[model samples]
Target: MLRTLTRFFVYVQTESNLKRLSLCSAARTGSAMTEPKLYRPPAEVRGMTSLDKDAFTQTITVPALRVPTGVLNKIVKSLKKSTIQRPGVPRVVQETEESSDSRLLLLDPNRVATPSSFSEAEAEALRSFGVAEELHRYELKLTYDNLKSEEVLEAVLPPGQDVTSAFSRVGHIAHMNLRDHQLPYKNLIGQVIMDKNPGVTCVVNKLNIIDSTYRNFKMEVLAGEENMVAKVKENGVTYEFDFSRVYWNPRLSTEHQRVVQLVKRGDTVFDVFAGVGPFAVPAARSGASVLANDLNPESHRWLQHNCKLNKVEGKVRTFNLDGRAFIQGPLKQELPGLLRGKASVHVVMNLPALALDFLDAFRGLLHQEPPCDHNLPTVHCYGFSKDDNPDTDVVKRASRSLGLPLEDRCSVHFVRNVAPNKDMLCVRFTLPKEVLFCSDEEHAEEPASKRQKCEDTTDSA
Candidate 1:
């Protein structure tokens, strides 16, 4: 049966299906109405053949079953229902003297007549219809397996150059960080990404992080629609935010879950540099009351929106304030109540850029209080380190920020690597009574030169 099916392909290959094809002006520009040639069909088929690159216009030879000419219309109908029938490719019929009672029914090749491609149900259907092993013999071409993202991109992009494969998908938008040389083909690359991936409707390129204060970056629409609002679901909670306005790193999802896992029911969380509440909302959903604050007003707005969206508004108090102010104001106000309780208290500072500098804000944060033995907020402060010993370097910076040694007081955890040399580190430490309650007057003043040097090294987020 398979051999007969294979032979049919060769028989159909010699015949023309130009009547089924949409004849272009160039194909029909002749005094005589000559049949149009197949759009770049294979000159010869020996073994398996790959489809033409121009899949839309390319034509392929489909095997036709030899049956009574009277039932040809019914056979066509059944084939159309079972396979992809291209209307542009015309059908052909042939008769031989020995097979005078039988006629060949040529159907659309692209539809479903390939020998190597058929479902079990299709095989059963063919057998039920008495499609025996005695039909014309020809080899059927198999369909090529789908290409990888990089492979598809390489074919579409310029040869010999490496295509950028790094992209962050925020909801339906694929965000790519293309370099300077790749800028000219940004639109083409974006379109290719959207095409190769499913469920992605938009593509954008990060131009630069222009407004550092808000963490809002400049982005150009490379492909798809010009919509910036993204709806992302992480840790089983949905977050809606403007991708162009707020800073939302889908990459930090693991980190968000890690921190939230530490927070249990009845615990209180203070998110100082919460951007769009990736940390705050999940922690709140985990049964912790959260006090989330961000320096960006847009982030503050979306944080509140997301809190309500998740129905965790009652558990979360949103604030738009600088990291220092958030520590000195709402956090300071809530610290007393948090300490008097039995529940755990977590302070999350995720802004790795300048969060180390904001550590000084924790010094003299709470005023006129004696050392409490009951509850001290465990600070989870993140910072980027580009040193030989990242752990030690992060601890040293945390110590300098707190105005106290953290070698014994803190535990440093490696978060992730941001770049070749830069590493993101999280220093988890119990807020020291000395630093948290130290009087402003007694706080040690650093030398002008020393403070300048500290500021220079800790400015990046």
Candidate 2:
């Protein structure tokens, strides 16, 4: 019985495509044809380039009942011999219980049967095969005019099964229109809200069109109050971040703590890429005067706000200007007190990616008579490692240009891995007195006689 069922199913699958076409054509031409109320093609049909014909053959061949060993062998042999040899044709034969025990015999090709005549012939074949049981069967007819457009699918399940539950188990099934647009965004927003990290925040649908144009775009998270607020407790201080108007990372404050530990008391620090006072506030709290600047108007505004929030507005002076332009500007010469002989000025190049490019300007900033006091403008440089080296090579180049001995004067304090196998390093160096005064040609050409006379005078004293 199982062998007979397998043979019947193989015949159905091998001929299904031809059968569908004939059925469709018959329905279209007949007066009794009624449009299917709920039937659609599977979504896979659109993107499907090819399929395994043997898979369908194997799928239909599951045995319905045991058969004699000899009969099974004979049926399997017959199926292998009569198997369709088309490129995508099946290699095995099978049948469902409705058509079990059926055998297919080729008829004379000279006679072509009509649609009704073919149906009658199929019914007769089922009867001759001893498949006498009356069983419920459903023919799922799916069609689509344009493959790219939406598709609908229908399935007939066994009795007592919940249709919705069965469909849900088949996870790949989706509604064409609903899945295309609605589901993806819903999943994204769900992920954002479910994220465990408190530091991570997402702004959703802040930009909305009103009237004739779009304007007044802002940031809004999915959770929290009407205003965005996050409170982080670190280093015995609870810092509140207002992310409504801007976005700020608390990790920067942690980095600032590291920077402060590197600086000694009474140090004047310059924070280049100062975003919302993360570095400046912490440095100022460490008793270092901070000169913080950023190019973004909104960022500078928030930097000022954060300074006031932390009550370090007095120690930190905020500037709204381009860092490189300000460094190269005439302020160095115009304000000798602020620039020249000011050794307490520690230049912080926090932006590691682009900091190496500004080495020349930074070096120029360090150039002054007696060079800003060793206590005033100390240059703290930052750079990241690449694949070629463990330490950033740019720092070596910057040190050489400043006339500082790479090993003796410079100190590499922190090397933190920002990415896999790549590190962010902070290096501090003090400019030599000679290099700062080297621009004075008269000083450079000082005679040995004058130098010896000064030495003799120092010995006499």
RMSD of 2: 23.4
Tens digits of lDDT, candidate 2, 213-241: 11012433333234344454445434454
For candidate 1, the per-residue lDDT at 340 reads 87
Q: Write the per-residue lDDT of candidate 1 for residues 74-143, one digit (tens) a residue.
A: 5555555433233233443555567766566553333333443344654555566665423342222322
The worst-scoring run of ten residues by lDDT in candidate 1 lies at 14-23
Total clashing pairs for each candidate: 11, 25
* Predicted structure with the largest lDDT when compared to the true one: 1
User: How high is the CA lDDT of each candidate model?
Assistant: 0.68, 0.42
